[model samples]
Target: MKKFAVGIVSAAFILGAGTAVFAAGTNNSDNGFSFEKMLPFMQKMHPDQPSRN
Candidate 1:
């Protein structure tokens, strides 16, 4: 039971971490800094869409 709980906790942590990682590039503005570095990669991922840059 203890091991099962640990596994669930770890899985939740990992999935939550991925959400945080993907959210990092959402604030695409120059107020202080931008996620421009991720833009090209995101564009490549969806090449059919027009680049927003």
Candidate 2:
């Protein structure tokens, strides 16, 4: 029982740490990748093809 409890706590701590790191990484807006910047180029390359879905 004690081992199980320790395992659960450790798993939770690791998950929480990973989530915090991910959140911190995503907080930076200037990661150099932007879809809005590339939109015009994409539009020029693929002009309004009807979706074949």
Candidate 3:
């Protein structure tokens, strides 16, 4: 029972740390990779198609 409890606590802590790291890594400081900015380029590339869908 004690070992099981310790394992659960460790798993929870690791999961939380992983989630935080993933969230931190996703932030784009340059603002270069945005849908709003890419919309024009995408439209120009596929003029025939209204939307990529």
What TM-score would each prediction reach against the true structure? 0.48, 0.56, 0.54
Q: How badly does each model clash, as a count of residue pairs?
A: 0, 0, 0
Cα lDDT of model 1 by residue, 1-53, tens digit: 99999999999999999999878855657654455766777778988998654
Model 2 residue 31 lDDT?
A: 81
Candidate 1 stretches with Cα past 4 Å from truth are: 29-53
lDDT of each: 0.80, 0.79, 0.84
Q: How should the candidates be ordered by lDDT, best one leading?
A: 3, 1, 2
Alpha carbon lDDT at 25, candidate 2: 78
Q: Candidate 2: what lDDT?
A: 0.79
Best by TM-score: 2
The model with the greater lDDT, 1 or 2, is 1
Task: Give the TM-score comparing model 1 with the true structure, all chains together.
Answer: 0.48
lDDT of 2 by residue, 1-53 (tens): 99999999999999999999987776555786466666667778888855343
For model 3 the local lDDT of residue 9 reads 100
| Candidate 1 residue pairs in backbone clash | none
Q: In model 3, where do residues sit more than 4 Å from their true spots? A: 29-53
lDDT by residue for model 3 over 1-53, one digit each (tens)?
A: 99999999999999999999977876775754766677899899988986746
